[model samples]
Target: MICIRLFQWGIFVALSFVGCKSEPQNQDQKSIEKGIERIDVTEHYVSDSYHKRHDGFDWVAVSVKHHGDESLWVSVRSRADQKKPTCTYDTKAFRIDKNTYESTYDGKRIRFEFFPTSLTISTENPDDSNMLYFFCNGGATLAGHYGKIDGELDTQQIDLTTFSKVLNLQGIGFNVSSIEKDNKNTLTIFTFGLENRDYNETFTIEGQVVIDAEVEDLNSDGSPELFVYTQSVGSGSYGNIFAFSVNAKKSMSQVYFPPTSENPKINSGYRGHDAFTIVENTLSQRFPIYKEGDTNASPTGGTRQVSYTLVEGEAMRQLKVLDITEY
Candidate 1:
């Protein structure tokens, strides 16, 4: 779609090296809403540095996709061997200009400048390039000019073993990464730029896989909330959410999400495959309803959409059902 949607929300293993297929932007899509500007770019680029090595080429590739209304999904990787990559980076870069985006990590700013047929990567301060060394090995740096690739980039070439996302608002940020090991996924979230470092936390999610995560100021409190969506591996694909709210930009607290099974009013015919997004200030969840005798592949019942509002509870914040509609 790379522009962050109405509310800004929110990686793979590279095993192979392939190019990206450029996709056309939809002209009818709105580029700005409520003064929120978005950069529209969905393309791939590659570097020729690989040709320098005869034993194993230093191949670097980049993929940029429209994320929401104001962000781009940017992924960069460098491979010296077909079995493993030397450098890998995956995160959301927020739009700074019509064709430029930037993301801050490890106290450094990495910028992406886009052109008609090329992309240039650089650091805000040239000396800050050293911070990027954390993701690379063997003296490989992600900062360089890459040429646009005309073909589709085989995403499978990048390692999908780990998923990562970076979200920021009001000077608070989070780096969320999930790594799967032995059928269990360990979700690690590192908070940065927080007024109180003690608020940062890491979690271990067993048996389920993280599908996606999002950040938003759901209560208009000026601080953001983190929403992590996950699904169990198997035929069911049952979805679950892990969320936290920033407390006055100092500490963080978990936001309770009522299970569908406990909420009898909305649980009828519920059977996984659910998707979620924030609409205005509410959390919106939509899923296909399954009637009796309905196979997992098909659901005769119409779709059910539910919206939840963030409210203060005695102990913690909770997402309370605001409304539900089916059609």
Candidate 2:
């Protein structure tokens, strides 16, 4: 029965990481109030050429090192690469035992478990049969994935918020659902079909809510594009940017650099604090612009640097700003 429900969800995630190591240490005092003293784990494997044109998929970079610096990073995907169905790993395949760590290649499998507060990743791929789950709580990053299609198995989840902490990219299929009341935010954008069985669309942003979301490919032509970031209640540091394009079907009706009542630049509505990137394949942003009665706690109107370029079969795959600098 699917390996007994994946061994009862791996023993309820190892007893919820042993009841979160009995709580109290508060994640080592929030990593010593951010002057982090320790937190290590590094493993990377990216067999280039942009993951061999997407479906051969293979990239894994989980380097969450702290005291030794280089704070956060997380990304995963593997269907076996590095030359034909070959997979590899060392360092005892990421040791760590009791706190969990596992590995398997060829048929693909990966796991890294650690919990006092959070950090998790689990993967599987019986040759694209799929299964994945990722978690991180230094602020937020959660994910889930499952697959099957025609025979039925599908599952998906994604929740993001990282305060610009960084989480890079990968295949990232869509499947987000959301709804918020008073603040008015609605988002339901699904789309599955490796065998066909899912489709949805509903994306609203009436008054803002939705701290962040990411998925990129930004015109790499390998599919993957959905970037949402919102904010607005009292509008302290104005923010809002939405970009969608999941190969099309009028999904979210295509929005990139939207928000216009005439001249709303800087990812749609300039203000302050904004930084997004998707290098090489292009899609960059940097914000901070105010001056018409400035306020964002004192901003005079200076930073701005946009750059986009996606332009696919019209109707809505348009994002061609190409450059707009100002230091």
**lDDT per residue (tens digit) for residues 1-327 in model 1:** 111134343221121122222232333322322134332357667776533434554566777776666777676655423655665667667888877788777567888776665666778888886665555555656666566777664443444545666677778877777766565678888787767674556677776776567788999998899898887677777778898999889878889999875789899999887767777788888888999999998999999989999999998999999999999
Model 2 / residue 18 / CA error / Å: 25
Per-prediction TM-score = 0.62, 0.26
Model 2 has an lDDT value of 0.41
* lDDT of model 1 at position 26: 31
For every model shown, the clashing-pair count is 29, 0
* Global CA lDDT computed for model 1: 0.68
Give me the runs in candidate 1 sitting further than 4 Å from their true place: 1-161
- Give the top-scoring candidate (TM-score): 1
Candidate 2's C-alpha runs over 4 A off are 1-61, 65-73, 77-190, 193-242, 245-252, 259-272, 275-327
